[model samples]
Every structure is written in structure tokens, then in C-alpha cells.
Target: MPVPEPALSVRGVSHAFGRVQALDNVSLSVAPGSFTALLGVNGAGKTTLFSLITRLYDNVSGEIRVFGHDVRRRPGPALAALGVVFQSRALDRDLTVRQNLAYHAALHGLTRAQTWARTEGLVDRVGLTEQIDTPVSALSGGQARRAEIARALLHAPHLLLLDEATVGLDVRSRREVLGTVRELVAEENVGVLWATHLFDEIAPEDDAVVLHRGRVLATGTARDIARGGDLASAFLDMTGLEPAEGRL
Candidate 1:
């Protein structure tokens, strides 16, 4: 049998703004049922790479593929098979949870019937069944985040790109969001590229990519990268940053 194509593939992709290079020959892949952590600081080119994948910024070099479809050549299908949750909250505060999802479904060209079915299922999946009729403004931060995630999955995208999905939530909420996505990987066979600066968000079994100064510094399982030490120390070591007081 032929080998399956990666769910998400970034090949030799690079981007720049004027004289500042934002990404340098960056490449990575995420397979179905896999969770890959994109480890990087604020200016580490994570957003630049995501913009290229989502076609927000055109790639000046290299190629991006979503589940065998080239993002540039087959943008329609490529985008259709991909879901994204940006760092910023995207929910409409005035709209009810169900209404927000319905609008997104319409944008995706889902029929009224399809929209209802998906909305019901996704709301339940994201643990928002009871809050489906609640206005986004009435929900807590974590609840709003869950609703946004449900909207992103409305199209049943095979690959999910979450940029700092758990930013403002408390510990319990953060764990809940992370666990929900991890469950999707196993139960729905979705691939995830979770971009975040939070080391604790990464689990030991996860595959990880370290981006520093607009380039990839390391790639391995989260545990391998940590090497029995904590992720903080490992990250500092890999990026050649001095450990404070000889410790992380």
C-alpha cells in the first residue's frame, strides 16, 4: 500500500516582512490522530507559519499541504479540511452559542438541516449542550472558548490548528480545553498543531517542535525533548539560553 500523506505538511516554508525574516525554511508535519505542540515564544514565527497555512499571508517560498491538497493550488478543499482557533476569542458576545455556530455553518455552506445536526452534536461534544441557548456574554471565559472550538469543528476538518487556545483560562479550564482536543485526536482521528508558549500545555507523549528566532531548533516527542528534566530547562538548553542559576 502507498504511504498516506500527512494531514498537515509545511515544506521549506519561509516568510519575511521587509528586512526582517519571520520564518526560515521551516518544515513540519502532523499526522491524523496526532497532537504536535508548536513550542515558541511570542516572536518565534509561529503566527507567521500559521498565517501561511491559512492563506492569510502568501508564502513567498516553499509549499503547504493540508491532507494531500496543496494550500496554494487547492485552497478550497485544503481550507475546508482544516480548522483553526486563533489566540484571540472569536465568539460574538451578543449571539447565543447556537446562533454563533449556525452563522459559521452558513459560512461553510452547510444546509439548514446540516447546520442543526452539526450544531447539536458539536455543542454536546464540547460540553456546551446546556449552554447552547446562552449568550456568549453570559458564559465564562472557558465556556466561550469551548464554544469557539465547537464552531471551528463545525466543518469536520481533519486538521485543527489552535494558536494559544488556553491563554486566559484558569488551571481547570485549561486542562479541560486541552483534554477536549486530545480526545478529538483519539476519537475523531483529528490532527492537531497546538501553538503555545505554555510548557505545561504539552504532554509527555506529544510530539513537539521548538521554534526560536524564526527557525526550528528541535523536533521530538515532548518527553525526549525534556530528557528527564522539565520542559523549561530543556527548552533553554535546546535554544542555547543560559539556565538561571544553573537550573531551569
Candidate 2:
């Protein structure tokens, strides 16, 4: 049997803005139906890589593929197979959760029935059946984030990419939100590329990539990347931030 193609494949990717290089020869792959964490700090080029992969900015060098379709050369198929939830919320604060999802579904060219069906299915899946009619502005931060994830999945993309998904939520919210996504991978077999600076968001067995200063420094399971010590310790050591990498 031939090896299965990864759900997301990025190779030799690099990007720059004038003299500032945002990414440098970055490469990583996300296995189908698995979760891969892109671990990096604030200036580690995580967002730049996301921007390139999502086509928010064109990738001038290297290649990105979704389910075997090249992102640069075959954007349609490549993009059709991917879903994204950026660090910033995309739901309209004024619109009800139902309205926000319906509007976005329309943008994906989903018909009324299709939109309704997916929304109904996902509302319960995201634990927002009651909040479906609630305005986004009225919902809690975690609820809103879940709504955004629902919108991203409205198109039924094969792969999901979330950038710092739990950024501002409280501990319980973050756990619930992250747990929801992990369930999707197990039950629905959706592949996930989750980018975050919080090492706690990842598990010991998860496949991970460490990106620093626009470069990939390591790739392996979380425990492997952590080596003999803890993840935070290993990360600081790998990025040459030793001694002290954080300040209050």
C-alpha cells in the first residue's frame, strides 16, 4: 500500500517584507486526522506562516499543499479542503450566532438547506444549541470562539488550522474549547494544525514543530521535543533563550 498523503504539507516556505524576513525555509507536515502543534513565541513567524498557507499573502517561495493539491498552483481545491480560525474573531458581534454562521455559509456558496443543516448539526456539536439565537456580542468569550470554529467547519473542510485559539479565554473555557477540537479529530477524523505559544495547550504525545525567528528548530512528539526535561525548559534551551526567557 502506498503511504497516505498528509492533510497539510508545507515545504521550504519563506516570506519577507522588504528587509525583514518573516519565515525562512520552513517545512512541516500534518498527518491526516491528527493534530500537529506549531509551537512558537510572539515573533516566531507562526502568523506569517499561517498567512502564507491561507493565501492571505501569496507564498513567493516554497510550496504548500492541502490533501495533495498545491496551494499556489491549485488554490481552489487546496483551499476547499482547509478550514481556519484565526487568533482574531471573525464572527459579527451584532449578528446572532445563527445569523453569523448562515451569512458565512452563504459566502461559501452553501444553499439555504445546506447552511441550515450544517448549522443545526454544529450548534449542538459545539455545545451552543441554546446560544444559537444569541447575539455574538452577548455570548461569552469561549462561546464566541466555539461559534467561530463552527463557522470554519461549516464548509466541511478536511483540515482545520487554528492560530492561538485559546488566547484570551479563562482556564475552563480554554480546556472546553480545546477539548471540543480534539473530539473532532477522534470522532470526525478531521486533521488539525493548531498554533500556539502556550505549551500547555499541547499534550505529551502530540506531534509538534518548534519554530523560532522564522525558522523550524525541531519536529517530533511533544515529549521528544521536551527531551529529558519539560517543554518550556526544552523550548528556551532550543531557542537559545536559556537562563531567562520570560519576564513579569
Candidate 3:
């Protein structure tokens, strides 16, 4: 049998902003039913790569593929199989959770019946059934994040890309969000490429890519990268950041 395609693939990809090169021949892959952490600091080109993958910014060089479809050449099929939750909170604070999801589903060409069915189905999965009719502003931070995840899943995309998804949440909320995504990989066979600047967000068993200065420095399980020390120190070793600059 032929080998299964990677869930997400970026090969020889590069990007720049005027004079500053943001990404330099960066490449990585995420397998189905697995979680791969994109570990980098604030200016490490994580968001730049995300923008290219989502087609918010086209790639000037290299290629990006989702499953078997090239993002640029086959945008519809590529994007159809992908889900994204950006770092920014995208839910409308003025709209109820149910309304927000329904609107999004509709925009994706889901019929009225399909929209309602997915909304009801996802609310319970994301633990937002009771708050489904409440405005986003009324929900707690964790609840709001869960709502965003639900919105992303409304289309049933095979690969989920989350950019700093747990960034401003408390400990418990971060754990909850991580748990929710992990469950998707385990039960639904979804692939995840989660980008974050925090080391604690990465689990021991997770495959990890250490990116710095727009280049990949390492790729392995988080535990292997840590080498029994810790992810942070391992990053410090790779990026050559002074101890004082070591926020990751």
C-alpha cells in the first residue's frame, strides 16, 4: 500500500518582511492522530508560518500542503480540510455562542439544518451546552476559548492549527484547553500543530519542533529535546539566549 500522506506539510518555506527575513527554509510535518508542538519565542516566526499556512499571506517560496492538497494550487480542498484557532479571540462578544457558531457554519456553506445540528453537537463536546445561548462577553475566559475551538470544529477539518491557543488563560483553563485538543487527536484522529511560546504547554510525549530565527533547530519528542533536563533549558541551549532572555 502507498504511504499515508502527512496531515500537514511545509517544505523549504521562507518568508520575509521587506528587509527582515521572518522564515528561512523552514519545514515540518504533523501526522494524523498526533500532537506536534511548534515551540518558539515571540519573534521566532511562529505566527508568520501560521499566516502562510492559512493563506492569510501567500508563500513567496516553498510549498504548504494540507493532507494531499497544495494550499495555493488547491485552496478550496486544502482549506476545507483544515481548521484554525488564531491567537486572537475571534468570537463576537455581542452574539450568543449558538448564534456565533451558526453564523460561521452558514458561511462555510452549511445549510440551516446542518448549522443547527453542528451547533448543538459541538456545544456539549466543548462543555458549553448551558452557555450556548449566552453572549461571549458573559462567558469566562476559558469558556470563551472553548467556544472558539467549537467554532473551528464546525467544519470538521482534519488538521487543526492553533496559534498560542492557551496564551492568557489561567493554569486550570490552559489545562482544560490542552485536554480538549488532546482528546480530539485520541478519539477523532485529528492532527494538531499548536504553536506557543510557553514550554509548560508542551507535554513529554508530544513531537516538538524548536524554531528560532525563522529556522528549525530541532525536531523530536519533547522529552528527547529536554534530554532529562527541561524544555526551557534545552531551548536556551539551542537559541543561545542568555539566561536573562530565557522567558521560554
Candidate 4:
């Protein structure tokens, strides 16, 4: 049998902004139902990579594909197979959770009934049942984040890209959000690319791709990349940094 195509494929992708090279020949792949962490420090090109994958910028040097559809040549279907939650908060503050999800569902061309059904389903799935009727501004940070996650899943995309999804939440909230996403991967078979700089966010079981200064430095299971040592130690060795607190 032929090998199956990856859920997401980035090949030789490079990007530049004037004199600054934001990304340099970056490449990675994500498999279906798997959780892959894109680990990098601030200004290490994590957001740049996400921007390229989402086509927020113009043409780049390499190719990107979602579920076998080239992002440039067949953008519509390719995009339809992908979902994203950026580091920024994107919820409409004035809208209720249901309202926000419904708006996004409509954007994907869901009919009234389909929209309502999916809204309810995702709200329950993301554990926002109690806050479904609350406006985004009234919800807590974690609640709003959950709502956004629900909105991203509203389209039922095959792959989900979360850029620093747990940036500001407390430890409990972070754990909840991370656990919820992992559950989705196992139960819904949704592929995930979770981008974060925090080493604690990556579990040992997760597949990891370490991005350092716009290039991929390592790729393997988290433990393998850590080389049987703690992730922090491995990180320092790979990046050639001296021991220090509060660094990547």
C-alpha cells in the first residue's frame, strides 16, 4: 500500500521581511490524530511559521499542504481542512458564546439548523455548557479561550493549529485547555500543531519540533529530543545556551 499523506506538510518554507529573514527553509509534518508541539522562544519564528501556514503573507519559497491539498494551488479546500486559534484573543466581546460560534458556522456555509446543532455540540465538547449564553466579555479568561476553541472546531477541520493557546491562563486553566485538546485528538481524530515556548506545556508523549532562530533544530518524541535528560537541559544543549532561569 502507498504511504498516507500527512495531515499537514510544510516543505522548504522560507520567509523574509526586508533585511530580516523571519523563516529559513523550515519544514515539518503533522499526522492525523497526533499532537505535535512547535516549541520555540519568543521571536524565534513560531508566529512567522504560523503566518506562512495560514497564508497571511504573500508567496514564500516553499510549499504548504493540508490533507494533500496544496495551500497555494487549492487554497479553499486546503483551508477548509484546517482550523486555527492564534495567540491573540479573537472572540467578539459583544456577542454571546453561542452567537459567536453561530457567526463562524455561517461563515463556513452551515445552514441555520446545522449551525445550531454544531454550536451546541461544540459548546458541550469544550465544556462551556454553563457559559453558553454569556457574552464573551463577561466570561473568564479560561472560559473565553474555551469558547474560541469551540469556534475553531465549528467547521470540523481535519487539522487544528493553536499558536500559544495557553499563554495567559493559570495552571489549572492551562491544564484543562491542554487536556481538552488532547481529548479531541484521541476521540475526534483531529491533528494538532500546538505552538508554545514553555517547556512545561509539552508532555513526554507528544511529538516535538524545536524551532530555533527560524530553522528546525530537532524533531522527535519529546523524550527523544530531550535525549533521556530533562527537556530544559536538552533545550540548553541544543541551543547552546548557558543555564539560566526564564529563558527558552
Clashing residue pairs for model 1: none
Q: Per the 3 Å backbone cut-off, how many clashing residue pairs does candidate 4 have?
A: 0
Off by over 4 Å in 4: 242-248
Number of backbone collisions per candidate, in order? Answer: 0, 0, 0, 0
Q: Where is model 1 more than 4 Å wrong at Cα?
A: 242-248
| Per-residue alpha-carbon lDDT of candidate 3 for residues 1-248, written as tens digits (9 for 90 to 100) | 98889999999999999999999999999998899999998889999999999999999799999998999999889888988999889889999999999888876788888888788888899899999999999999999999999999998888999999998899999999999999999999999999988888888999999999899999999999999998899999999998667574
Clashes of 1: 0
Kindly indicate the candidate among 1 and 3 with the higher TM-score. Answer: 3
**Native-vs-model 3 lDDT?**
0.92
Q: How accurate is candidate 4 locally (lDDT)?
A: 0.89
lDDT of 1 by residue, 26-73 (tens): 999998879999998878899889889999989879999999999999
Q: Please provide TM-scores, in order, for all candidate models, with all chains considered together.
A: 0.95, 0.97, 0.96, 0.96
Clashing pairs in 3: none
Writing each residue's lDDT as its tens digit, candidate 2 over 1-248 gives 99999999999999999999999999999999999999988889999998988899999899999999989999888888899999988889999999999998887788999998899999999999999999999999999999999999999988999999999999999999999999989999999999998888889999999999999999999999999789888888888874345210
Give the worst 10-residue stretch by lDDT in candidate 4. Answer: 239-248
* Candidates 1 and 2, the one with greater TM-score: 2
Per-residue lDDT of 74 in model 3: 91
- Sort by lDDT, best first: 3, 2, 1, 4
